[model samples]
Target chain A: MEIAKSLQQTPSSYIREILAAASDKNVISLAGGLPDEKTFPIDLMKPTLETLSEMPEVFQYGATAGYTPLLNFLTDYFQLPDTHIAMACTGSQQGLDLIARAYVNPGDKVVMEAPSYLGAMQVFGLVQADIVTVPQTEFGPDIEALRTVFYEQSPKMFYAVPDFHNPTGVCWSLETRKQVAALCEQYNVALIEDAPYRELRFSGEAIPLVSDFCPQHSIVLRSFSKIASPGLRVGIVSGKRSYLEPLIKIKQGADLHSSVPMQALLLGLLKHDNFDYHIDTIRTLYKSRYETLYSELQDKLPEGCEIKPVDGGMFVWVTLPSCDTFKLAKELLKDGVAVVPSPVFYPQPEAAKAALRLNFTNATPTELAEAVSRLASGLAKAI
Target chain B: MEIAKSLQQTPSSYIREILAAASDKNVISLAGGLPDEKTFPIDLMKPTLETLSEMPEVFQYGATAGYTPLLNFLTDYFQLPDTHIAMACTGSQQGLDLIARAYVNPGDKVVMEAPSYLGAMQVFGLVQADIVTVPQTEFGPDIEALRTVFYEQSPKMFYAVPDFHNPTGVCWSLETRKQVAALCEQYNVALIEDAPYRELRFSGEAIPLVSDFCPQHSIVLRSFSKIASPGLRVGIVSGKRSYLEPLIKIKQGADLHSSVPMQALLLGLLKHDNFDYHIDTIRTLYKSRYETLYSELQDKLPEGCEIKPVDGGMFVWVTLPSCDTFKLAKELLKDGVAVVPSPVFYPQPEAAKAALRLNFTNATPTELAEAVSRLASGLAKAI
Candidate 1:
């Protein structure tokens, strides 16, 4: 069978396959950046199911912009006008795909953060865009490098995870975000600020989106997958009317709309008194697990190894000196533990082969400790 | 604001806007091709939602293919082997979009039925494909015309809704389907068999999909949105392993996956004894309403006006004599009646202006009568 030439060249998601293989076991899997299912407000959702069942059309076809009530809820929650918001399914990945479709023509230039979410990189690749990854410093991306890249590529958009950045878990500082926003404004480039983990702040005050600087040019994406239920496949896109209206049109062509029942249920949960209370509880739960894993890695890992403790979100990023982390990850999986190989997160695979992302949210405290111990042992053996 | 250049050309869904505008007390909208909400198994979904709430992780990020249980249920229901299945959100529109992304290169040659589903045409158009629509005869698309077009264009794919086709509400005869399938096989052309209205058979024996003739080269899409709840956003795609695999990859990039809670709830509903009973109940309900519509139009419509009494599905495709449907539709809107101008369904906008699509599913029998009377009055006055 002659497959699509593009698909023939496309690589299947390695993380997706490994996650599926580990699902049936007690594999201490930290590979997938999934929120702990124990924290998803199922009790609140239980009543929500019943409430939405009363209006069956709520379980039927909805506007492509997503369910109106949920969009309204998100607009109010994000402090954006109703015109600035549109919702999507599949966490923030669908939002990324929409951005790719609406903005990037073939061979168009796009700038992304080094070690950003693997899925976003894949989206850029699928659109056949020329992607330049600007290196991130301790707090955020290097602004000077961005300026050089902008001059070289004349990129149309910069895709960034400003809050609790994926794979690396570094949030942009308020000043850095403003700086980048100003640069984008200077270059007239769009900023795709993905903040799927914005609300899971275990520490630090929440910063307003980069959209604050140039509302018309900045597109911000937030997802329920981290704070609530990823299985619901709900995410919100907020930007100025100029960017959002085009996105809504692209969304209609893409999926007609997101799931109506899921949006209705999410709206019900949001309206419930216990919604914020449950998110607070989840924050505390993940905070302890993250702290436990961070300490374990710091103590057990080799002296030259570095670990970045995430302020929020599910992951803890680790870098090892002179070790094949991907090989070590496979060895750890053999020991019934799994950590995502960080090479998958990069535009060029060889650049990030020595790093790994360990998710602390889904595992229990003991499991998190045991998983890190296994990784430590595997790293020692591999080195 | 410098918007992405790609969006500058992508046409907005004209039908979707009309659907939104018609949501009022006076508007009798026939614009949306929606399955009747009253006929859906809404009550049965109550327990399914309750059961889903118990599994919190079901609300978390799901497998890229879809929820496993739903996939398994759909596989068994469709009687297809595991190798040939994929799941999509909302309906098969997403499936079509994913297929377009995976297979279509810019400026590719594609083929379509003369007046196929506008949504599918919208997708092909977005990919910048040159589409040739074979004229539809009473039986189906003209077989000889298809052969000529297929040979001339050597299209990337032939998109057709053979099972109770959309807009026209015409099902291709099994003989025509086989002839088309055999021709596709001979020419090495891929076929997309979109069959949302398959089980909505008002009469006549069910025809097995054309894919059964050339499964290796065809993608068959079915949806629960028509027979069940569109709000859940569940649909099934089945074809050769070679075709399905690429579609699955596209699915991964498109939305990670559909909602797990919705998928699980749907799987639970499929397990019930009342599942087929509910489908039959829908068939009976729609059949009666369709008859009422056909009789009313026949009685009230002016001489020389043509209306097709469809065997299945939710719409009645009408072609008025010597009247501009675009203008008449606006006039009808003023008189509290609405219909979609059928020219929008055609690939070439200049092909027809006298046709319109009236939906029978959403309106009640009494409401249908009033709507049709208004349509008659609108037509009589306009013509």
Candidate 2:
């Protein structure tokens, strides 16, 4: 059977291709947005794992929304108002898919930062959404450009990652958060606030989620994959009941519901006394790795190449002097390092500036240093 | 926010509404197609659950295809051809959903029996497939009608449940299976064989899957939800590598694969020494419940009400004298029994015959008898 027209339009993920190549034993991969396997809070989850056999009900089919205990807990955990609710999904990735499926009609305009979460772009692309882009500033999205898009295009939704963003690690400033939220409210476009890296903040205090300023006009996709375990494939989506009900309905057909055992396990871990401390440890560990990658890049990158320090999250973005990044990435891989070229993060790859996204959370300080040496030497020759 | 136009065409699941009402303690519900909670082999799964913490690899991000060990085991266990492969999904439900999303474009002709799986209709509806239906018979689909549809419409695929089919529990006769396979091959139509209840046979010898006859032209969906635990949400889709890759691509955006821990847990349960015996016990238990409901309906059902005995699977369909099944179902609920009305099962509700799908698995023999009592009296009043 021929694949759907929609699937044909979706570019196979470049990161997946590079990651496949990066698996060579000699290569040190900073190409993937993988949380270090060692950082998984397996010990914190052990008590729940052992107790699951006793909870036979979890092994039965679950409510389409989620397991009740988890949903109830999340409503309070996220401080959702009576009008709002929470739904558990296979992952926040699925939550994003649901949003696109539920709300994005073909040709509907969906706004996003030019370099944004690739998975988000994938989902919206599958629905054949007309994805419009705005530039990202150090603070957040280029707010003036955003206003012009909203005013002219009148997009259905503006998708954003306000916490330590994937690829860029740019946390939206509080002022930017409020401004984006206000613009959303004014334009009546739904705000899809994706915060997969919220708890990974290492050096900076947390800023309010952009959704907080316009809760009535926003939906929040929160993930435990970073602080908890992605292998469990559990995440939470929250918004006003009216906003979330469509997603819940779509979810019923998406996967029935997420794994109940995973949900129950997540609830147990959340209730554990040391779960908060577990997040702290992930932050400290990732912070150290980020520092190692940052300092190494700063020292070795050729003049005119630039690097930015991140307060938290998995990646450091390096702005290279204009060059063919795909070729550079391939050459760097031959030198025993793997990184994602910036074009893969853009909806229109040709519009992307010369840059590379290097992940810090999945490697050690020594490995990070070696990868940078390979990257710098490779880049110096290319530039 | 208004839902997308695609979602707008999809009907809200009437089953959900009836299931919610069935939750009343006073109601003996046969409305849901739930396996008995007692059937879950939690004890058999315990050893794996307890040891999951020791397997840190299962707690990290896994391949989008599935957990490696589980995939390898299933590929071997199913005895798939060298060119065939297995990929795990959130459930067979997701397997169906992915097939629709990956292969069916809006207005693509997809074939199914008139009264078919609601979830299949749901996923297909979400993708705007132009569903074409053939009438079903005691043997399987009406062979003449199926042939006419396939030869004339040339649907992209024929979606079927060849064993102990849902709603009707009409396990196809061997001849019918072969005939359907021949028609699919002749028409060059893809066969989507969904076999969630294939293993639940208790009274008759098992028949070969329709896919066995049309292996090169089919994709098979196998579910453990009935034989194992639905809460784990693990199911397998297998076909030639070319046929399965598109689904794996769409699946990356769907949920980035099913939960890895759930996949691991399913793998352990499948490998347990007593797993086959556990299935035997479920078969025996459901057989007894089916007998009780079948006999009670035979003795007490109103004149003109017709019932069929099922050898396996969860439900028995009762065709009634021409009347409104929705009204009959509502009256039965008030009489303290809950059953799914036949109309709810159809893509076009008005085309459904007046019938009720009574589940025998979740309720006990005693409860099944009582539910039939309520159903009989309510039917007598309605007719």
Candidate 3:
């Protein structure tokens, strides 16, 4: 029948396509950014779930802002000022979605990194925003490109993954983070810093958050998906009241509130003394997987292919000379291995055809090596 | 700060305003449609939670379509056809919101029952849809009005709560249900039947769902919030594949999927033979509260005020002759009772000013009586 113009303009999730291709029982999936299920902290959560089940309020309707204790815990943990407001989201993706809803009008300009999180791009597209991309360099988004776009477009918001960006394992340099924040402030654009991978760092010193540089102009999204549990779908969006108040209002109609039992379970985990130890364990596990995948790709890939060095997060972005990653991805699937084509991440199609993203967190060390060898063979055929 | 045109046009949730006014603990709240916490199946869910906590898959990222077992269970429970597809939402509110996203373009016409669910109205407003209303008669939406709007406006969708409608507490006659389906099909408009209160019916025979009459042209939203647990936030939207597929695709960007552990716990409860018994207890509780409220209003209210007859569901719609319910509501609040003024539900403000909605399910029978006495006294002063 008649579909919304926004829905008509929006494309189905590219990640879902990759997921469908990787769903075969025999395939080794390095396409999805899923955390290792073996490290889900089930034993730790059993007692927490038991305690939560006894509380009737845990299963009753809760405040749309979120479970109070969890919000308090996040505010305290982040050391946010009293002027800042924090709300729980079903996931960080929802946090991004709400921000887009609160600020981006149809045909409004939204500036984002070229190879950014596909989910965020999908959200902007769904709202029918005119997305302008700034090419991302090794350290972060190209500051000059951002400045030029900001001056030319006066975009409504700038969305970035400052810490260990999705699809590309690139972390912003501390100077670049501050500069990006300063430029957004200069242009009066709201900044959305997506930090889902902040805690997954294996090496390199931590960069200060973009919000830390411009709290008044930035909204930071944090998630428990990588470190705690994804299935629970818990995340947070913290920002100044002017911006956050509208997002909270929109959130009420979005889902009323995130699930209360889910929030209580997260609150329980955050209250536990050994929560940091659990995060450390996760970091150690992913660090090993990252090393295995990176080294195997370097040793196995054909000559014209290049893998970027990554300090943290689930994915590694690889560039292949004279290759269409979408075609190569399909060819690789025939070899029983799956990786995401980079075109999904780019707003412009032409810039995305030569690169592919490989997630290192879901597969084992041995599986990573085998998947890479298979990918190399597939690449040879495609080239 | 540049805000979206849609958000600029949308008003904040009216329930939030009522909630803010009722935040004072001294006020007896008959305003919110919250389920009684005592009726929540806490003990029934304990064993379920224990089993879910032990399973790592419950905490891992789940299928965007939903947890398979839960989907299968719902399909069988509803006796849905093979051509129908079902997906889990964080809550049925989300199901409504996604439906709006999938179909209602900015400036597109939407036909809905007058004084419909405020939450649904807010969603359509957020998407900038042009909402056209059809007035409610004693039996259902005035079919003549609906037909006129359908032919004149050709609205994208018709949103209705056919069974024990919200705000009005009126169920459509079987003839009306079939008429709604036929009219929608005739005009090529999709029907969204929100059935959150279906299982909470305490009296009267259940009318067949609208989808039963026109399977391909209708989508049904069902929730566990009222009958099971609102805190768990579980719900489903089932419809023909064409409509459902787009909703699922949009759902991926709207929180990915409903929480898996929450769905698993629901599945566990469904598997238990006594699940219907839990729902029966909820119905019995509400039935008592509704009777207490209706009887008290009839005894205490001034001659000009009238309470509609309600067979089941949580609310009773009260119409006051030549008076502002908003002013009456404020006076009642001063007397320590809270109710939702009806203007929030109506698309046209003037139409809503003479009515108010009282929720019968949240407070005890004694509390309901006390609240009604206070409301009647306040009305006496206002008139």
Best candidate per DockQ, number? 2
Tens-place lDDT digits, model 1, residues B235-342: 777786778777778778777888888788888888877888999888888898899889999999987789876789878888778666667777788888878887
Candidate 1 local Cα displacement, residue A195, angstroms = 0.8
As a whole number from 0 to 100, the lDDT of residue B185 in candidate 3 is: 84
Let me know the TM-score candidate 2 reaches against the reference structure: 0.99
TM-scores, all models, native as reference: 0.96, 0.99, 0.98
Put the candidates in TM-score order, highest first: 2, 3, 1
What global local distance difference test value does model 3 have? 0.87
Q: Which ten residues in a row have the lowest lDDT in candidate 2 chain A?
A: A203-212
> Across residues B1-383, which tens digit of lDDT does each residue of candidate 2 receive?
88999899998787888899999999999999999998899999999999999998888888999999999999999999898999999999999999999999999999999799999999999999999999999999999999899888889999999888889999899999999999988998999999999889989898788998989899999999999999999999999999999999999998897888889899999999999999999999989989999999999998999988778998899999999888878888899999999997788898999999999999988899898888889988999
Q: What is candidate 3's lDDT per residue for B31-94, written digit by digit as tens?
A: 9888988988877888888887668887888988899999999999999999998999989999
- Residues A325-374, candidate 1, lDDT per residue (tens digit)? 66777778888888888778888877764788888888999988888888
Residue clash pairs of candidate 2: none
TM-score, model 3 to reference: 0.98
Clashing pairs in 1: A59-B231, A60-B231, A230-B60, A231-B59, A231-B60, A231-B61, B90-B233
lDDT of 2: 0.92
For A307-343, candidate 3 gives per-residue lDDT tens digits of: 8888899899888886677777888898999999888
In candidate 1, how many Å is residue B103 off? 1.0
